[model samples]
Target: MLNTQWRVLFVFIVLLIASALIANHLTGRVFNYHDPIGSVRAIYEDIKTKIEMAEESELTAIKTIAAPSLSAKTAMQKHLPQADTTRCVDVSLGKVKYKRNGNIYTWTDSNGVPHFSDEKPDFEAATLDTDFVEPLDYFELTLHAANLPPSFTEELRIKLNTVFKVYGQIIGVDALKKVRLNLTVFATRRSYEQAIKLRGADPTNTDGMYFHSTNSALINYRNEQSAMRTAVHEAVHAVNKAILGSTPRWLNEGLAEYFEYTKNSMQLVSVEPHPGWVNNKRVAQSVFTINWLIGLDDTWQTGDDTKLYASSWAAIYFMMDSNKGKQFLKSIMLAEQKSPCSKLTAAELKNMLYQHFPQLDKDYRQWLKTPFRKQSF
Candidate 1:
């Protein structure tokens, strides 16, 4: 929506420039007796004023329709008082439920895999290090929490940073330099549910969600690893809302699941598919054809079927693995952001697939037969 408004403003600016040029050309011929400079100045000012009003009206409509709460409206208004491109406000971390004590603990488990915890470890070898706190301005993502363990918070911050880095590289870092996505994580499901209720959204059976109006992702801290995955998933939504306006549900959710796993390496610098940590093999085998997957009516609104999730990941995975695929995905993302008021028809989607992947049908079959490999990056 924001991107649409800016595009509108850009058109207005171009029109203004053309108008000025025409006015200058006509002034001498139409009114030779009068001062041409003064007439052009008046015309320019009038056009500028009208453009500003149009921009304001568009913003007002967005505020009334899109912002779900009074707080959200107020925040949008405060941050976006005008249509200044460089002054746009990307998303920021909104709420933190727990206070920071500035402490971090390091310990090793029985398997010798090292772990960090906010609480002091029972192991005599555990060490407390208060010196290595994550600075607030050090990264592109901010993690807000409620009663979360400091160690877990630190882990989330680190992992989410890696997620952002990997995602930025995949999508092109220059495209995302303007986004600052935020994630609000709660220590318990009870707190997470309560927060969503207060915000006027149904939690339903969802473990995580990203609110565009509020510009933040929310998650409940369940099992540490699972919670991190949830956080990464929702973070994808937040980033998409900021950078791409609105995305198709398949691409949105697939990209989230793609980044939800921890492969013991934070540096995922390549496009090779991670041996997806999610249990999606059965679904992939069932929905073997890309045509069958895209044939499902209303692909954008398809609900949380395991088959849908697996197929979505497969589609994105296939796209991201090659340079041509990455470029196509990038073009789609830019197009989606540029068009907030338009909807892509089914025929249009099919044509787009063929344009980008001429051999999609044959290639997809080959992809299904190939064994999934754990990513080296």
Candidate 2:
């Protein structure tokens, strides 16, 4: 009985030992009871949540870093003005911006047009070096006499106004309506002569040329009638420039002579045809002599220096008298805008003259042969 009881006890101890080993194996393979599988699963879920949160945080950081750069670019685009794309590259001092349709400058409007802005750059003001008086529409004459005769200046102004009226009639009064004529008289002939000589011109030339510098015309006081004629002559030249771009040098000097001699006198005059006429006689004498004679052609040479004044006066008179003469003058004026006189040939000019004044061919030829009484002023 004792041996059987001991055997049972040994069996029980072996069974207990085997049970312990099996439980250890099972725990290691399936559940891992020492490490706790549920705890490991909870740790994995926490790690995954942390990883997702980290990713979101990194994305937010990237956006925050990029926001300012994008905002800055947008702000710059909004602040900048557009530019004028139609115009060639603008070198003007202003901020420029390019657009789809046109370019806009910072200082200018949508069409790249300028505005009266205090901050805007002054284009005209910057270039103006001298004290410039803006032109007036109508000028009131105030003749202050020093050494010059008061009558001479007064008569000069009257003759000037008359020639101005003549040209105004031809090219419309509105053309010269805005021109301001200021005539200042000088006491000494030396001053007037010095002024002319400075311009590389002869002072004795009765028809004084226009001075573009001051817009002021000067005439010497020799006699009232002569001074009046000189004033009218110069004033016509100025009027011609106002109406027509510029009267040809020949036409200009000739017209000046015409005004000097005629001045509203209705008399038949003949012109002498001589090469030395311009050199020997005064401008008035040369022109008057030629007006009395005939066989003169409208085709005049450039810088002929002889008979220039005479031929010019006759041509101008011929044109002024004919129906188509005025139209031809207009054509000549228009042509001058495109080309110089040297470019036009003698034949072309002759054809133009004939086309304008067909009656000139016969009447002028007959007038040249006929003798007329000369009227003295």
Off by over 4 Å in 2: 1-154, 173-177, 182-187, 198-207, 262-306, 333-351, 358-362, 370-377
- Taking all chains together, each candidate's TM-score versus the true structure is 0.55, 0.44
- Write candidate 1's Cα lDDT for 296-319 as tens digits: 635322232545666777877777
User: When superposed on Cα atoms, how far off is each prediction in RMSD?
Assistant: 17.1, 38.2
How many backbone clashes does every candidate have? 3, 16
Error of 2 at 366 (Å): 1.9
Question: Model 2 reaches what TM-score against the true structure?
Answer: 0.44
* Candidate 2 deviation (Cα RMSD): 38.2
Report the lDDT of model 2 for residue 235. 57
* Model 1 weakest 10-residue run by lDDT: 75-84
